[model samples]
Target: MKLIVQIPCLNEARDIAGVIQAVPRQIEGVDRVEVLVVDDGSSDGTAAVAAEAGADHVVINKKTLGLARTFQKGIATALSLGADIIVNTDGDGQYAGHSIADLVAPIVRGEADIVVGDRKPGDNTDFSASKRTLQRVGSTVVKTLASIDVPDAVSGFRAYSREAAMRTTVFTRFSYTTETLIAAGNSGMVVASVPVDTNAVTRPSRLFNSVRSFVLRQMVTIVRSYIMYRPLRAFMVLGFGMILIGLFPMVRFVYFYFTDGGAGHVQSLVIGGALLVCGYITCLVALLSDVVATNRRLEEEIITILRRMEHDEAARD
Candidate 1:
């Protein structure tokens, strides 16, 4: 199978050359490797440097599209060029060249569709930086929001089988590592994390900015997907919770009204009316939410269709 290694870059002129040059060779039973460098509008000489370093494909995005779109373009281009599997890593020297073979094993062996490189900050012995204090916190919050259990959710190094790559076309345009895990799980692919080394970059790293933006995108994506994938489920949950809590007061007010004989208690009437109205409105909104959810799912399906066609044609070529 043809393998494409995508290195999404911003302004890393210093090590884009090194990254491309070090695209791991000689793993048993491996065939060809095509290294793709996505140059995300670097004002520096990153594109030139990657080309000079002999990258198989140098995809230069016209503008700075941020991290997610940068990676997506490379993925699309790689699929267009008939890549059977895609492995991605940072343009900085944080990821080791040797780790790629291990990353691809799960995909090649049919054990998983997406394999993530788990980067532990303890591996960063060189730099004074500790594990991102907010990284784990942000991940936990998003997990609660999205109902997923992914650790080390924002590391960039990963490998994807063709099936997984095709399914990711409908994802958030500005997503990164966090979003990828959720997207993979949403797409019904098994997502696994394997250990990898994270080291000081040859160039300064903007991964934290990339990580923060990615977390926001992931939250939005999960919320949107939550509604679309199961509008009925979302509605039932919110509506049911409110109904039960409101029921106690509602029943009490009704008994007081009937047994005590008609609008005899004006306060009870007002309170009951307000509670009922609020609960009904919530259920109504939940039902209407189904309509909105249908439209979103349709939009995602359209993107999926287009990308699927692109992927199939590329494989044909």
Candidate 2:
């Protein structure tokens, strides 16, 4: 099987060469291995450095498109280049390149559609205590939403089979790590995490400048992706909660009215009625949202089929 290791770079000229060179040129059960560098509109000569480092392919974005888009572009390019498997790593070399073999083993053996590299809990000495705590919480939240248990939900080191890669699409611009896992789980792709070693910290993350910002952004991403994938369920829970809350006040109002012959509880009646109306509206919105979510899923399936057919035709050509 042919495997392509893709690195998304943005102003990473200093570390790109080392990341490229560290990629294993040969692995058991893989006939060929190649490197693809995606330059996210880097002004620091990252593309030139990648080429100089002997990257098999380099695709440059005209403007900075963020990590999600850059990763999507890299996947598309890898598919076009006849890559049977795609492995994504960072351009900063934070992940040990030598561990890529372990990452891809499950995919090569048909045991998993996607393999995530687990950096091991408490292993990142560079991360502050607060950062590590946040990481744990974020990973737990992602796992609950995605229905997949992954120790390192934010790890950039991952491997995807061609089928998984073809069926996946990244919608959020903030990060691909979390969204991809949720998408894979929603699309019924088998995901497995294996322990892998990480290289020492190379540079600070470009995704977020501070821990506060990172937490805020990641929380937004998780909420947005959850809504996108499970809108019906989300809306249903919200609607039900609102209804229950409204019912409590309404019940109290009714009890007061019955016991006192409708005396001195006019305000309670008004408040309860208002809440009931709001709850009913929310439930109506949930129904409409469910229909839209179904349509969206159908559209996605059609697009996936068309894309697979196109890829097959291209391969034949």
Candidate 3:
């Protein structure tokens, strides 16, 4: 078995070397281990530093494509390199390298397709009170959306088996941590989480400018992922909720009209009628979206088959 640890870097020149070197060269069940550094248009010579630090492969992007795109690029490169297992960690040296073996153990033992390293951000002293609270709330939202129990849903340290890597596809431009979990859960891929150690914060997050911004982006990601996987259910609930709320005003208008001999209560009738129209339109949209989602699933199946064929040809070559 060969394990490829991929680090996605963006101007992390100072810490990339240590992160690469920190990875263990020998794993109990893996025959070989290698490091792959993907430079996200870093102007700080991150790619060069990774090469000097003994990274087996370095893939450089021409321009910055955000974390989500960079992560997908790294995964593709790792798969092309014939990696039997892929472990993703940040280039900032935040995740403990020694914990990598523990992180990949579930995949190595065939117990899970993907294993996430739970940093228990709520208890981490390095984070502020607000950040800790955000982590807890965000994780709860992700668990519900993904239908998976991951304590640290935004953790960057994670391991994926070869099959898992081949089947995974990410579309969000923000971050992969949440979207991937939701996708895996929806796809019925086995996911497990293990406690892992974290180093002190080396730098502030570049993903968002403020707590509000982070929360907004994460919520967008969560909602989009949930809608993608469960559009019918999501829209059904929304349509039904709107319809239920519309009924209250309509019923009130009817009661007031009957009691007051039907004078000057037309406003409520108009408002409720508009709401009902909107709710009905939303339900129609849900049906159309369900049809689109079915087409997407069929396309995905075709893509998966093509991917397997490509991988088989690569192996033969």
Candidate 4:
């Protein structure tokens, strides 16, 4: 089996080489292990450092395409290179490279399609109180929305089997950690998590400017992904909740009409009727969105098939 460890770097020149060199060159069940570094328009000479530090392949973007797109490119490049298994790690070197073998072991053993390296941020002394709380809340939100039990929802260190990598697709430009997990869980892909160690933080987070920004972006990603995968249920709940709320106002208006002359309560009736109409419209939207989501699923399957064919033809050539 061939394993490729792919690092997605963005201006990480100071840490990229160490991350590349830290990757294990051999594993028990793998015949070959190679490092693939994808630079997302780094101003620093991250690409040169990677190549000199023993990266087997280096893919550079002319301009920054953000993390999600860079990760997508790395996965495609690794697949084209005949990687049977793919592991993704941040170029910042915050993740311990020694845990890579443990991360991919589940995939190598055919036990899981994706294996996430759980940093256990809550237990880590390195994490501040606020960071730990945010990690816990974020992970809980992911687990609830995706219906998957992942301890670390935002971990960059992960492993994917060939099939899983081929099937994976990321629509969000912010990050792939949460969206991919939601997709895998909703699509019934096997996902497992293993405890892993982390290195000391050498640099500030480049993902977002502040904690508030991170929370907002992650919330948007989670909600968008949840709606994308489960549109019917999501809209249905909202529609019904609106209807339920409208009912309360309508009932109040009726009681006033029967007991009294219902003078000022005409406004209640208007508000309730408007809400009811909105609820009905939302339900209709739900139906349409579900149809679109179904089409998206079919398109995803077609894309996977085409990718397999293209890769196979390339292998033959």
Best candidate (score: TM-score): 4
- RMSD per prediction, one decimal? 3.8, 1.4, 1.2, 1.0
Clashing pairs in 1: none
Candidate 3 clash pair list: none
lDDT of 2 by residue, 1-317 (tens): 89999999899999999999999999999999999999999999999989999999999999999999999999988887888999999999888999999999999999999999988756678788887888788889988998898888988899999989898899889889888898888878899999998887867788999999998888888888898888878877887777777787778878988898768777777787777777788778888987888898899889888878887778667
Candidate 3 local lDDT, 1-317, one digit each (tens): 99999999899999999999899999899999999999999999999999999999999999999999999999888887888999999999999999999999999999999999999988899999999998888888878887889898899999999889988888989999999999899889999999999999978988889999988988999899899988988998898888888888899899998899657888878888888888898898889999999998888878878877777677567
Off by over 4 Å in 1: 121-134, 137-149, 170-173, 201-218, 255-275, 284-306
Q: Could you tell me the TM-score of candidate 2?
A: 0.96
CA lDDT scores, all candidates in order: 0.74, 0.89, 0.91, 0.92
Residue 97 lDDT (model 2): 91
Candidate 1's residue-wise lDDT over 178-289, tens digit each?
A: 6566556655678776777665555545744554564565567667655655677777777767666667666777887778764556665567667667767778888888
Q: Number of the top candidate by lDDT?
A: 4
lDDT of 3 at 276: 86
Worst 10-residue lDDT window for candidate 4 reads 308-317
> Using Cα atoms with residue i matched to residue i, what is each candidate's TM-score against the true structure?
0.80, 0.96, 0.97, 0.98
